[model samples]
Structures are given as C-alpha cells and as structure tokens.
Target: MRTRALLTPLVLAAVTTAGLTVAAPPALAAGPDISVTNTKAHLDQLQSIANANGGNRSTGRPGYKASVDWVKAKLDAAGYTTTVQSFSTSSGTSYNLVADLPGGDASSVVMFGAHLDSVSVGPGINDNGSGSAGILETALAYAASGQTPRNHVRFGFWGAEELGLLGSKYYVGQLTTAQRSAIRSYQNFDMIASPNVGYFVYDDNAVGNGVRDDFTAYYDSKGLPWEYIDVQGRSDRAAFRSSGMATGGIFSGAETIKTSAQASKWGGVAGKAFDACYHRACDTNTNLDLVALDRNVDTIGYMVWRYAAKDYGTTTPPTGSNLLANPGFESGAVSWTGTSGPITSGAGRPAHSGTWKLWLGGNGASATESEQQTVTIPSTAATAQLSFWGRFDTAETGSTVYDTLKVQVVVAGVTTTLATYGNVGADTTWVQRSFDLSAYRGKSVTVKLVATEDSSAQTSFVIDDTALTTT
Candidate 1:
C-alpha cells in the first residue's frame, strides 16, 4: 500500500492535439487498443499461480517464482527479451523481471512496471494483480500490432515489493550515469481494480501531475471524473524520486475508506475501503472490479503508445554509433551470458520501443541472478557512456531487510561497483539511469547487472534498453 500525503492543488488539464499533445508518427498511427479480455486473462493466470503454489504469491515463496515464470513465458512467446534479477532480505531471496522491445530511439526511453509479488496473507489479485495484468495485456497488444515507435519502451515485473521496496531500489542503484539520463518518463499502476474503486491519480510533483493529467484527460474523454490523491512515499514511485528521476503512476485505493462524494462519482460502497480484501486472504481474482480494471488497462495502453510513438519535443534524436552489440536485446540476448540466474527475452510489458528486452531475476529463494556483456572501447574515444532503462519492485516484511541489484564493471579480474541498489522500498516505474565508463576507454570491460538476495521473502528487479557509446 502507498503512504498517503496531502492532496496538492488540482489542476485539470485538457489533452490537446495542437501544440501540447504531439501526434503519433506515420509509422505508428493510432496505436491498437488493449483487450480487456486479454488483461483479465493475465489475472486468471496469476490467480492460478497463487492457487497452485501456496494460495499466495508472497515474496520468497514458491507462488512468487511461479508468477514470474508465467509472465516471462508469455513475454518470451510474444517476442520480447527478458531478464530476472535477484535480491535478498531477512525474509529470504526474491526476484525481479524486466522485458524490453527492440528497435526504437534508445536515447529517449519510456517505461511501465508493476509488482507481481503479493502479501503473505492473500493472493493480492485486486491489490496488484490488477495492475500487473493490465500492463501485461498492453505489452502483448503492442507486440501483436508490430508497430514501430519513436521512443524506446520497457516493462518491469517487480518482486518483494510488499516487504519494502528492495527490488526497485536495487534496480535504480545499478544504472550507469548515462543510462539514467536517457529515460524520458516512467508511469506506474498499482491498485487499479479495487472492488470499491475510485479514480485517484498521484498528484505530488510535476511528473506526477503530468501523469495525473493524462489519466484525467482519459477519464474526461470518457465522461468520467477523477480525483487526486497524494501517495508521497508509500509505493514504488518513491524509489524513482530518491534518485532524482521523474516518476508518476496511478492507484485506486488501499485501506482508506471512501467518502459519499467518491461513492457518487465512482459508485461503490461509500464507507468501505476501496478494497476491503486488500492484503487479506480473500483478495482473489473474484475480488476485482472488472469494469475498473478494463478502463484503467485501456488508459494504460493509450498512454504507453502515446509516449512511445509521439514526439515529445525533448532530447535530440540519437546519432553516434553504440559501442556495444545487441544493445537493446533485439538480437535475442546475443553476446551476453547469464552469469548466475536465467536472462531471457519477451514482449510482456511496455518497452522503450522495440519487440524485445533482456530480463533478470524472479526465479526463487536465495538466488543470485546476473548477466554480463563484454564491450571493447576504442582507444581514440575520449569519453564513453553506459546507459539503460530500468524498473524494480521490492518489499520487506517484519525485521527482514537487504535485497540488492548491482551494475558493475569488470576489467581483468577486478570488479568495480558502478551502481548498487538495496531496499528502495517502492518504485513501480521505469527510469533511465546511466554511469560514466570513460575510465574504461581503450579496454574491454564486462558490464554486468547482478541481482542478489540475502535470504528469502524479498522482491524483484528489472532492466532494459542498454547502450554503451564512446565518442
């Protein structure tokens, strides 16, 4: 659940097609609408995973690993590259899964992510399976259309988020300085299908406001009204903001009781919490409001395509050559090795722009998932940059702590930690992060993304859109 904050000033902004809202490129006319039926199908799978494993996909549990495997398999079949990253905490080890699509401007990246792990007490279908399924369906729809975009897109399925924010933090800490700068924006969806739902948008910062506005515009376009809610640091967005990255996302409601006004607008029980089954044993697939899930998932698809295909008039288009081969995982994880756990490909979630991405962790307990690629830097190059987009969702329960994701440079036998992440608490959005590799100019170095879990009951981490450039 997200921590609550005072609502900021509500400013409803209209979506304009003129100057503010950029039109989609010729290559990507109006993107395909996501299928609500398909999104609900994902939720069904998650529920099945939980039922078959332990009645709950809690971190460090078999159900969690099963959930990750199910999602990865779907993404792989859809032509996306995926990776599984591992992290540890007092509860135990956990994982994060990241998927990337091939072929888009790597410089300007967009991301969307959701947490796949649930609390120990329940299936957590409405609490987060709603979001996970919504994003998953959107990714699959993108793959089915086979459309190209102007910006890169990535998707992340986080682990151990209910415990704290371990997985997402680890992912953020592992980015190279150059990678962080390439990300254009990150959007997150947490509890979008609560039984007694409300259309609440995160309105805390400029980035958040923009996301809220986009959602509001979507609702307005459908003749629906939305209210603003400030979740200051309760969820995954907190991890992005901690690293000075722009972040935004949506949530329905958690344990907070709805008011009569909200009931009038959204039509649910006025005094009940948006999700009375939140974190409880009854948070099964049956706990969701399908109408809410359908609408939010559609909105998710619309925003993802809008950001990925439209020219936001920001950074210049990428030019110079990339030093690393298969930088975007478009080539099916070529020139890379899984040093520990498995790294694969899939079309499971929104990517920076292509049809694939490399995913790490989400396997099981006490896992050490990692992948590395060796790149040679030209001697004449004065500066080198390593960039990528990443998203993570982690958790901590009780006294358990410690889950990590690391980006490191290995030259000869020595490994230097370029970035390190642990216990980010919550961040459900993709952020572009980068690290300077100038010191490795004129040499061959192994760039690695490592996910480590301390014990069990931890979370997950994800990464994509990798690029190494020297000029």
Candidate 2:
C-alpha cells in the first residue's frame, strides 16, 4: 500500500463545531458513557499513529503492524485473553488480533470484528480505518461499562483485508467444525463511520426479515435519516454469510458514488461521492468529518447494544431453500416435423423461428436436431394464458435478408401453428413480441420453434421468458 502526499492543507477549518475542537480534549459532548467517549479519543490516537506513518495503516507494513500492536495492547489491558492469529499471504506476513470475552456458555459466541488493514493506495481512512477505530472505541467502552453480554463476545482485527478478505477467510477456515457450530452470529463493521454525511444499515440476512424496518425505526426515532443496503458480498460479512451465519453491518461509503437523487434525500453534497478518499492517500486524520463519524459510531453502538449485548430474539432456520426463492428455466427441448432440410453448420439459429419458416428452408442455417425438453406449466383457470417473448439477430454475413420465425404448439397430442411471425430484422433493442395461447388455458401446451427460410440464410432466434400467466 502506498500513501500519496496531500500538499494542500486538509479542509479541517470548514468542519469545526462550536465549543468542540479536535485539538482540545473530546469530553464536551454527549457520549454513550464516559468510557465510550474515551473510546472516541482512542480512535483519535490510532488516527494519529496511522497519519504519522505515510498516511496509511496497511497489512505487512510498519503502520499496519503498529496498529495491530496498539489494538492487542488495548485488549490485553482490558482483562481479556488475547491471541494473535498470524498467517502468511501474498501481500506479506500479517496477523488478526482476537480477544475473547468468555461468557457463562462459552459454546455460543458472538463475533464483532473490523478489518484492521487499510488500503495499500491510501490511508484507507474511510474504507476501514474508520471501522477499526470505531470497534476499538466500542470494545473499550464495553470493558469500562462492565457490560457482560450473555454470549461469549469475540473482538477481531482482521489483517490483509485490502487484499480481498484474505485474513477473514483464514480465520474462518481455521476454526474446527465444533467451533464453527458454536458461532451464533457474526456482526462485522468494515467501514462503520466515514466522514461521509449519509447513514446506511446493511441487510445481510438471507431472508429479508424486518431487520431493515427495525433498524430504520431505531434511527428514525432519533431523528436520523438512515439508508438501507443489502450486504451483497461486498466485505468480510461474506465469509460468515457463506457459512450460514447471520451477518450484518453498517457502512458510510467506500468508493461508490451517490447520485444526486440520493444526495437530495440525504443532506450530503451532490456530485461528490459519499467518501472522496475511498482508497486514496488523502485519507488522513483531517480527511474525516468527525461529526458524521461520531454519529455513526453511536449508531453502531446502539445496534450492538440491542442485538449482541443481550439476547432479545432467536434466529430460525430458513423455511425453504434459496433454490425455490428464485427458480429459473435452465434449458428445455422442442420437436417439429417439416420439409426435411440438411442441418447447416458454422451458423446457429434462434430457437423462436416458427414452423412455416422451417418449411420454406429460409428459417436458418441449422435445423432442429431433436426434442430436448417438454415442460408443463400450471396456471389458475381464471386468468390462465400462455405467452412467449423472444429476440432475433440477423445473419452476420450482411446478406440482403435472413430467416423468418414461427412457432408450433401441441394440445391434447394434436399439433397446430399457435402463432405465425414474419422476418425479424436484426435490432439491438429487445423486441417485445407476444402470442396469445388463451385457447389452451389451464392445459399443458407443448411448444417448439423453427428457423428455416432459404436454408442458406444463417439467421438465429433467441427465445426467453416462455410462461403461462394468469392475466
């Protein structure tokens, strides 16, 4: 990781708050608890260390190792047994600092983690340094408050995170099968607090539970505008999610630009992305908007206090497999009897070309080889109807014309031309074409496609979304 020098003075003067100065001690404002406020100062200390060393804290680097030492020392001082899980990686030798707060039932554990590695390009202030500092603050606060969470609470500082989650995957992979089962939930904070002005609560639950709604209600009750995002395999949460553990976190912004519409809804400036430094060297101490960052830290503290601090609810197994959640047609087969034309090679035809075109030998270069699949779709009698949508691409030879398309349907073992279509010229836009099979309502309709016109033409038809809809 390389840090770029920002010759320009950070725009810290623009964010100065009344009676609240970064240069002064951080005790004038309200905090979760007195200890929690000190935790914020803890972040300030880390930020100072990272900034002093080339404006970054990256894995295998001196700044990164210093950050690890600081966190491990903090955990050791907190009366917890600490372990340094070191592993070799392409980036270099790195380590994940883990500390256990064992509970009455050590069998069940709750994990709270944030990647300690900053981006190689920048100080990674907003990307993950923000997240790491917040976790430190929370852990210190948890220690000072003497809040004994029921489940064993584990804190982690994952290394080499900038190298595509290598540290987290290693930690998860090393766990024995029994230890893996003991994990009840994983709450990871990758970029909890950014100088970015907007708030987001990620939804990582496999099933869309009322998590987002609950999170919204919690923040809205505090007069805050909170945005919702799905944990779509963006960070360390993916590791826990793959192992069937409930996962979720909060993020300000990484590198993704927020549109004007989003900025309008949220009060951040438009055109500028949520976080400007994202993964750049400019992410120094002054790069953050502390007002926004502190608020997000409190937000995360609130969520953890409510969910991981104590057990208010239990997680249930999913009712159904994700397979049925979004079932899709993989492949199928169709057959048609027409003018027996020689199967052409080199050129493929679209499956939507109809039967008459097959008789004319102008459908396509290749003829149907055999019947592959016959699907039976069931629909409500009230609004049952069969419809098909397909796309056609003209032959590539740049010929004056290409193949024509048609379709055939089988009802009660009787074959007939259900729909007829003319030549579909090559066009880039999707042509929305439909056919009414209302006559076959509530019945199994077997369908086949043809692409035979001037057997010499090599046009092809691509078919999609063949369905029986109740409309």
lDDT for position 296 in model 2: 66
Where does the lowest 10-residue lDDT sum fall in candidate 2? Answer: 323-332
Each candidate structure's TM-score, on Cα atoms with residue i matched to residue i, is: 0.66, 0.57
Write one digit per residue (lDDT tens) for candidate 1, span 1-471: 532245333333222223354434223233356787888888888899889887999888899998998898998888777778888976788988887775454555688988888998888898689888988889888878867766767888888788776777776666655466666677778999998988877775655466656666676667666776667656676777666666777788878788776787679999888888877999998898888887888889888888878575543223357755567765444445554224345444445557666555544468787777665566677788899987766655553456778899887658999888765553658889989898887665778888887665555666778888766
Cα lDDT computed for each candidate against the true fold? 0.73, 0.57
How far is 405's C-alpha from truth in model 2 (Å)?
A: 86
The superposed Cα distance between candidate 1 and the true structure at residue 398, in angstroms, equals 63
Model 2, span 1-471: residue lDDT tens: 112343222111112233653343222223363233554566667677777787677877778888888887887787655667778978689998877653322434677788888876666666677777777777766666767465556777898877778788888886655456656767677665555466777665463244444455556656565566654555786677788776666666655566565566556777776777777777766667677666767765665565545553343212221101001122111121122232212133332333211122334555542111222333333434445455555544653444555577665567787665545455434455545665665444555555555556555455544444444
301 Cα displacement, candidate 1 (Å):
0.5
Error of 2 at 340 (Å): 80
Model 1: residues >4 Å from true position, as ranges?
A: 2-31, 314-471
Residue ranges of candidate 2 with Cα displaced over 4 Å: 1-40, 207-214, 312-471
Candidate 1: C-alpha lDDT: 0.73
